[model samples]
Target: MMEKMNQDGALETEKSLKRNNVVRERRISGAVAPGAGAVFRSVHAMQSTLALGSSFESDHIWKLGCLDGSSPDTGKGKSQFKSSSITNKVCHGFHLVEGQSGHDMEDYHVAEYRKTKAHVLGLFAIFDGHLGDRVPTYLKDNLFNNILEEPSFWEDPKTAIKNAYRSTDKLILEKSMQLGPGGSTAVTAIVIDGKDLWVANVGDSRAVICRGGVADQLTVDHEPHSERRRIEKQGGFVTTLPGDVPRVNGQLAVARAFGDENLKAHLSSEPDVRQIRIDSSTQFVILASDGLWKVMNNQEAVDMVKHIKDPQAAAKRLTTEALARKSKDDISCIVIRFG
Candidate 1:
């Protein structure tokens, strides 16, 4: 496996380098207000020039109307839940432009049933992919399912989530040939018992909760500079480019992610988990790729969506705002509102 990885490492590193450049540009450009609705024409053109592979169409792949907390199985792409135990609204949106590959991945499973247990839960996640779409796509399909299958998920969720993350990373490494050399940052939110929320993350994808109209970050970003100690201890180095941000190994910007077999020795898939008890103060939660985060802070995002009423519109506004600010990465987001 090491030998095979060595052969592909060079090519993968080159791809990661390009993606890093895009991220660096976003950082260098300060945050643009949500009202600024002008798309950075040059940035989009640059992204198109660097984009590899076939382009995907931007049709409404799936849509669900206002579901009044009746069904748990409302197909894919959208769902809403409201009951005595929980009152929540969920909405997801994505972007796929011409001449560019849509690499970001997202998934939300509402009222997911347990095989042995009789519990129903909701799972929401956003994955930011670099190099290729394989890693994020795989995570969108498997990560939540794997966490549910951990058996101990109901009793000790933290342990279950941690184990699932490591096991899933192993699976990605073992299947690298089919999954490719790409990697992805992930942020996942699990709502159980209808009143509690558990969030986990790896890399820069983020989860933020709006409590009393104030934004509270649920997960910490795993960037190269933030995890310098861990990286150096693992015999890996983080490098900073002039006028740019720090990157892991001078290649990948994120310090932790799923896949990236060549950097697995230094990188970690172990997620930071946080548990929250929903109350009157908790307005809504936003799980999004870095594209939205690159241009908006926690308060700005919450402020933009607090009065929107519709979760889908809130998510779309966030993504659209990011693009307007010249964000070059694939943007995706999931919004969940609680009563």
Candidate 2:
């Protein structure tokens, strides 16, 4: 069963898993203030229910918020929610701030929970776009759905995530005419029954988990300089000019990303996938775009918010710190606390 609250604040229920793919766009005209996006919360308990579309549903409460390019707010917002399982309590919060780049916010995120027949899935991701927000927006709506649709998701999650990322990149390339000549870096995490976590990434967006008070990075940052051989083998060159990071073919900065029709031949969208069993030593997980990582190290971030019990406040603190450090890129962050 699926329940969706539309823009009019009306709840609509669907009995089946089959649903239309509708892209909802909200246009904002002025600078958006901090925490100025659509915020909603849903609560559910453990039950033997079918998976409802891509939205969150279960016995636990989850909060989600996304800001597309339409918001006029100086590109800042926050949202958070908490949920519990028989073994652990899960709570998540996200914060976003548009950079001083003089452009609309080009970062998007997803943080919610869903119930399958036998498990509760915590789905979270960060998509950071360059050139345009279209690719990231598209990812926000479709990437996780495609990953879950893979036949091997349950038995071979690593392969399933890789296949889904490749296929999704193909779709984005095919739709580049509409999505624009841009691309997005993605980092995704799937937590099963609040215990098993599967993380995958393409490009720089990163995922870090805190275990026993130490920060363990779960995602790889696919940088052009680090993967120069791969790019050169594909007839692409990595360029390093003064005052600029290495770039593929002197164009894109990352070696892997979704979309980028013009650079498709040089870039790869294959994600590095990793899986870990969540246990007692696990404290929390952090997912954020390069904006935050550019200013803070994994340990610094983990330490800054480890003492903050509220996940939402923790997320905000990270973004606020990044801004204080003079990070000039759009910043997006998610904090998932496990206890």
Clashes of each: 0, 15
RMSD to true structure for each model, in Å: 10.6, 13.0
Provide the overall lDDT of each model, using Cα atoms, as 2-decimal numbers.
Answer: 0.62, 0.71
C-alpha RMSD (angstroms) for model 2? 13.0
Residue 295 local lDDT, model 1: 83
In model 1, which runs have C-alpha deviations exceeding 4 angstroms? 1-116
Q: Estimate each model's TM-score.
A: 0.73, 0.77
- Local accuracy of candidate 2 as per-residue lDDT tens digits, 1-116: 00011111111221222323211211111111222322222211111122324544222212223333322221222222233443565667666665655444577887656666
Off-target runs (Cα >4 Å) in candidate 2 are 1-86
lDDT agreement of model 1 with the native: 0.62
